[model samples]
Target: MRTVFIFMNEASQAVEIPKDMQFEAVAELEIRREGDTVLLRPVRPNWVSFAHEPTASADFLAERPCVLKTDYFDLSGAGESSEEPGQ
Candidate 1:
């Protein structure tokens, strides 16, 4: 099956996922704080112009077809990316 991956960035990373594409839990969101700066990094991520607002994700699924995945890293150990739901 074909897949379309979407990555989130610091600017819009805080936006809530659409209701249709809502998953049991959100994948881990990586945030880094240093001194007085904060950085938000997405797992590694688009827009569907033709889809209706409510059905955008469903439409996207129909077209390219994809499974939502969340990538996460273990900070305590090594920052290794993992495919497990929330990592």
Candidate 2:
């Protein structure tokens, strides 16, 4: 396994992808976290994940009033197996 370093870039952090570990063909990469583990995967051509990817503002997950003003996700009782369609 190769080693890398983390550095600052503007307000976020960036990992210095070593020359040998670089993905030169891809312009962008998806970096996400799962629990305590972080994963970095390359975006392949015609990737299915890009076709219908979920998008939101950078702070959309935040509880800030300005960021989230509506009940975008307050569908607590909307869908249920017992409920009828178009009810």
**Top candidate by TM-score:** 2
lDDT of 2: 0.77
Model 2, range 1-87, lDDT digits (tens) per residue? 766788899999888777877787788777889998788888665768677877888888577447545766777776667967799
Q: Name the 10 consecutive residues with the lowest summed lDDT in model 1.
A: 43-52
When superposed on Cα atoms, how far off is each prediction in RMSD? 24.9, 17.0
Model 2 deviation from the true structure expressed as Cα RMSD, one decimal place: 17.0
TM-score, per-candidate, Cα-based:
0.19, 0.43
- Candidate 2: clashing pairs of residues: none
